[model samples]
Target: MAYVINDDCIACGSCLDECPTEAIAEGDIYTIDADACTDCGTCADVCPTDAIHPA
Candidate 1:
């Protein structure tokens, strides 16, 4: 399964650079493109708010 960004996201932009596939998109809450996500968990590790998780 792909990783998902939840409402807990603080829009910190921390996950963007950490995403190897560049699946993350900028927004008020930010979002992850499921099609591009590889479930690497890299983005989730860098999320300061612990917002990203398994889908």
Candidate 2:
């Protein structure tokens, strides 16, 4: 499963650099491309707000 970024995301762009597959996209809360996500959990681990979770 892919990781989903919740509304708690601060749009800090921290997760962007952590995504190896370039699955994350910048936005008001940021978004993860489920097709590209590897489920590596790197984004979640680096998220300061812990907004990323498995979907």
Candidate 3:
């Protein structure tokens, strides 16, 4: 499974650097590219707003 960035994201960029697979990208609210996500859940760990979730 891949992780998705929810609309609650505040673009704090915590998850972007936390992703080991570099699947998360910066955007208006940040986005996770499922193709590259390894489902390691690293990004979700550091998300202060808890916007990253399983997809």
Candidate 4:
């Protein structure tokens, strides 16, 4: 499974740099590219809003 960014995302850009595979994309709520996500959970670790979870 891949990590998904939920509506709780604040677009703080915290997860973007943390993703080892560069799966995250900037947007109103931010999005994780499931195809590129490596399921490393690094993004979730740094998310201030705890918006990232397994999908």
So what's the TM-score on candidate 4? 0.96
TM-score for each prediction?
0.96, 0.97, 0.92, 0.96
Model 4 lDDT-worst window of ten: 14-23
Candidate 3 off by > 4 Å = none
Over 1-55, each residue of candidate 3 has an lDDT whose tens digit, in order, gives 9999999999998887778888888889999999999999988889899888999
- lDDT score, candidate 1, position 39: 90
The true-versus-predicted C-alpha distance at residue 32 of model 4, in Å, is 0.5
lDDT by residue for model 4 over 17-51, one digit each (tens)? 88888899999999989899989999999999999
**CA shift of 33, model 3, Å:** 0.5
- Cα error, residue 47 of model 1, in Å, equals 0.9
Better of 1 and 3 by lDDT: 1
Pick the winner on TM-score between candidates 2 and 4: 2
| Model 2 lDDT-worst window of ten | 10-19
Ranking by lDDT: 2, 4, 1, 3
**Model 2 C-alpha lDDT per residue in residues 1-55, reported as the tens digit of each score:** 9999999999998888889999999989899999999999999999999999999
Measured on C-alpha atoms, candidate 1 has an lDDT of 0.92
Question: Evaluated with TM-score, which candidate comes out highest?
Answer: 2
Q: Write the per-residue lDDT of candidate 1 for residues 13-39, one digit (tens) a residue.
A: 999899989999999999989999999
Query: Candidate 3 vs candidate 4: which has greater TM-score?
Result: 4
